[model samples]
Target: MVTFIEKGFLYGFILGLSLGFFIVPYKEVFPMGEGVTETTYLNLVDFIIPLIRVGVITAVIGGLVGFFFYRKKIRAYNNK
Candidate 1:
């Protein structure tokens, strides 16, 4: 069984990536929509980069919150 803190990080990483994991360039028309046409291309980012960035932020937060809640549960269990 995974610890609550670990599960927190895991769930957070998945949720964060699912939220905004893509970088899609928008089609931009410039110069009063007259001759300049900007081509929009889909940029494929390596899964590692966002995972690391997002994991560092949201996962840590989740782990801390999980730790806090877990401690509360433990205390309740012990008192019972």
Candidate 2:
């Protein structure tokens, strides 16, 4: 049980951190607004802040999902 939760958090953290590379702030993932006509590069703080924010959010979500998914297995193991 503990191991499963730990693994979930660990994997989630890693996955979230890596996601930063693919996703960024105001990325217009589901764009329905006007198209961009300009471009600009992000500074260190600008880029990093989003990464950290996304990382933490994803990590928590990942941990929770893992816990729920493995809850049954954990109970079964304890019964044994």
Candidate 3:
């Protein structure tokens, strides 16, 4: 159970960091001629912060799921 939780956390952290890398290149582009000036910029901090937050949430959920499955398996084994 502890191992599952640790693995879940590691996986989640890696996935989140990779996603952040992908998001780093994102740029919001505003088209001109719509009564608005064209603008493009990357908000690295904003994007990364959310990715980290989601990653942590995912890690917790994954850990809980692993724990639940482990418990279920143990129960089934004992019943047999």
Candidate 4:
């Protein structure tokens, strides 16, 4: 159970970082509506902040999913 949560966190972190890398490069192509400044450009901090936020959120969701599936498997096995 704990192991699943840990793995979820690790995997989610990696996944988020990968997504950030892919998205940051094409950020300029995505229109942000007028009035935005160049400061909104995909900088290191901007990329990293979303990476961490998404990673943490994904981790929690993943952990819950893992826990649910694990429990389901165990219940099925015991039913036999």
In TM-score terms, which candidate is top? 2
- Residue 4 of model 4, lDDT score: 67
User: Tens-digit lDDT track for model 2 on 1-80?
Assistant: 57777788888888988987788763323434597354456677888888988888888888888888798777888899
Task: Please list the residue runs of candidate 2 whose C-alpha ends up more than 4 Å from where it truly belongs after superposition.
Answer: 25-38, 78-80
For each predicted model, how many residue pairs clash, with residues at least 3 apart or on different chains? Answer: 0, 0, 0, 0
Task: For each candidate, give its TM-score against the true structure.
Answer: 0.62, 0.68, 0.67, 0.63
Candidate 3: stretches off by over 4 Å = 19-25, 34-39
lDDT of 3 by residue, 1-80 (tens): 78877877777677766765665555676768768777676577867677787677767777777788788888999999
> What are the lDDT figures for the candidates, one per model?
0.67, 0.78, 0.73, 0.68
Question: In model 4, which runs have C-alpha deviations exceeding 4 angstroms?
Answer: 23-40
Candidate with best lDDT: 2
Clashes of 4: 0
RMSD of 4: 4.7
lDDT of 1 by residue, 1-77 (tens): 14999988887777666653553222334454757666654334555565567656877887887888899898999
- The window of 10 residues in a row where model 3 has the poorest summed lDDT is 18-27
Global Cα RMSD, each model: 4.0, 5.0, 3.2, 4.7
Local error of candidate 2 at residue 65 (angstroms)? 1.9
Candidate 2 has what TM-score? 0.68
